[model samples]
Target: MPDTPGDAHQSLRDLVYVQLRERIIEGEYPAGRRLVERELAETMNVSRVPVREAMQRLEQEGFLTVQARRGAVVAEFGPAEAEHFFAVRESLEALAAQLAAQHATPAGLKSLERILTRTRKAAEAGRLRETVSLNADFHRAIVELSGNPLLQDMMAPLDGRLRRLFRLTSGPESTSPMCTEHEQLLAAIRSRDPQAAADLARRHVAGTRAFALSALGS
Candidate 1:
């Protein structure tokens, strides 16, 4: 049987979902930005069916909200929410770092160092947006290196949320601090020190939470 639109809807929907999700997480669709199906479909060069499906998924993911008159808009959270969210993220990612240290592979460490190199370049160029993305990539590499499926699943959503928060407060002052922290964290992991890696990861994430809160004037 030939493939039909119905059969492809799921695939198309997933593709559309990822694109929209990336845009939202990267701050392209900032908080309260109205997401119009027509606009998104046109922008993505696709029909509204997949766009609508993706938007619904995004709403379910806490990245969007269906309002009375606003339709779908990017979700926003309060300062307290930010604090709580990062606190949980910090805890989980610290666990990831600990596991990564225990299971650190040469290839995994090499991949992390490559990401760190790119992050440094992005930061040196003073591109906060790109830096935020690279920073996300760096931490994501670490989390994935941990090889824990549960940790991977839990940190998935927080990754997007963290990217959004990082973009908000990822200033020049934030750049060098994180670069240094990344080095320490990497060194601990490389040295096979799980406790040290966990401690560094926690402090690093805690510092980011503080930076974000201060940026929010909290």
Candidate 2:
């Protein structure tokens, strides 16, 4: 069967979503900047339908907020929000690592190793954005390897926010250290030590929380 109009519209919406999300994450659309459907549609040379759809998705992901008088604006991610996010992240990720240590299959382990290899290369090449992105991928891969559908469901909403925070806190100096932490966590998981994996995952979250807090403060 031929592709339907709905399929084409959905594809455009996804493209617009990725582009807008990246712009917001990269600070191109700073917090409090209003997003107009018409303006963005003109800027991207696309129809308003896809732009509107993308903005709606972004708002749902916590990247944008809809105002009463105004339409949509970039949402502010303040220090207080970071604190709350990290507190949940610490517990959630610790459990994921523990479960992964217990249940990860050989194929899952190999997938994680591949992500780590790419992460190391990105960090070594001084690619801060790519490194941060891969770091999230590593954490997410572990969560999936945990063999827990509940955890994956819980993480879905926070995934975008986590990536935003990572971009906010990561720098050239921090990328290599984050890689080291992931390496240790992966080792614990590979060893099939639930306790060790949980501990290392907790510590990793602590380090990231500390850095995020410090970055937001300064």
Work out the TM-score per prediction.
0.90, 0.92
lDDT of 1 by residue, 1-218 (tens): 22996768878888999999888776788889999999999999999999998999888778899999779999985587688888788889899999999997999999989888888888888978777888899899889989999889988877777877777667888998898899899999999999999999999988888888888775
Error of 1 at 153 (Å): 1.3
Model 2 per-residue lDDT tens digits across residues 1-218: 32998888888889999999989988888889999999999999999999998999998878999999998999988899899899999999999999999999999999999999999998899988888888889989999999999999998778878888888878888888888888899899999999999999999999989988999889
The collision pairs in model 1 are: none
Regions more than 4 Å wrong, model 2: none
Cα displacement (angstroms), candidate 1, residue 38, comes to 3.4
lDDT of each: 0.87, 0.91
* TM-score winner: 2
Number of the top lDDT candidate = 2
TM-score of 1: 0.90
